[model samples]
Target: MLKIGPIFNYLQDMADKDASRMEMSIPQLMEKGYTWVLHRYHLSMIRYPKLDEALSIRTWHSPYKNLYSLRAFEMTTSFGEVLAKATTSWIIINYSTKRPMRLDRHVTSQYYKEIIPFEFDFSSLSPLERIDLEDIYPVRIRDLDINNHVNNAVYVEWAAETVPTNILQSMRPSEIDVIFKEQLTYGEKAVVQTQKEKTASNVFDHVILRESDAREITRIRTSWKNMPL
Candidate 1:
């Protein structure tokens, strides 16, 4: 089965392609001293594609809300089976100041189209109340993206690392919600704290913190399903 990290990269790549079609690619934005940063993601998977399987991914953006933009994605198999659907929120920030910038009228009115691929609330996700397991991983240069911060997909992989071995082997994530709080850089250590939900045995909540200051970097919730026999 495909892992969440690779799936996330695929979705991001599709979004980049869509942006490029609109002449809003990362390099284009960078030339203007601005770049898009992901704020939140909600991904729900029906089934992961198998190796060598062909799939189609479609992505589109809705009208911007001030400095934020909402992008939606859908992945389908060749037979037209829906494999996954995702919604992401992003903010355009000035590269020098690192502060969010207002969406330009042309960018908002001309580029964005109102499209509802799937309905999902962008509300804040609940945090982990207690820690059932914890692990630490040192950030590596390879973990950083072009932005010089930890890649968004790495957070999901970090959260998954805290899962119990038995659950990892027997179950697959069906839904994942994530909120990125702060950036993590190379040489930093990430402490991943996780808790299994009491009410939902197959659900887990995770918080990634900077080991040095204990500052929260990301929050994630994952719901798992038993794999087929």
Candidate 2:
């Protein structure tokens, strides 16, 4: 099975590592009372590789819009086959106040080295109606990132766990969209809910809400295709 965990992690890890090269790392931003938060995710999975395979990632960004920036990524194997491609939305906000802030010239100049065209269109992103599956997820220590909140990628892994086994064995996710609603912290539990429209067997709708106060954590829409043996 192609575990959906590493791709997003690699995407994020590369972001931070690359940012540090330009002196715009997370710690640097945090010192200014600001930190970047992932707001949205869009991934297109073309194929999965086996062990002993290595992949390369190429990422670029669009100009920041107010407080938001759009980034594009493509992951290719050593053979130059595109395995996955993605686009994500990020926002920098004041940590103490939790308020969105505009990107200043100093921050933007850090990583504007190379400008690459966006490989995916943003128009396809549309709101997905909430689906209520009956499962509850508890956040643990391992789920937290450096920010002490649940990492954005953890939401994708949690959603994958809720997927039915029969579907998991036979199908693979071709497309995934994750829209973050709120942040999850330790000691909180999330209510896992999902819905799949009968007319669209390949598409599944997912939502995760904090059980403590019924606050939404995230909403994900995934499209699947038959796995090749």
Give the winner by TM-score. 1
For model 1, the superposed segments whose C-alpha errors exceed 4 Å read 105-109, 113-118
Best by lDDT: 1
Q: List the residue pairs that clash in candidate 2.
A: 133-193, 133-194
lDDT of each: 0.85, 0.78
Candidate 2 lDDT over 14-61, as tens digits, reads 888766776767788898888888888898888876666788988777
Per-residue C-alpha lDDT of model 1 across residues 150-225, encoded as one tens digit per residue: 9999999989889998888888888999998889999999999999999987889999999999999999998899
Cα RMSD (angstroms) for every candidate in the order listed:
1.9, 2.2
Give each model's clash number: 0, 2
Q: What overall lDDT, based on C-alpha atoms, would model 1 receive against the true structure?
A: 0.85
Error of 2 at 222 (Å): 1.2
TM-score of 1: 0.93
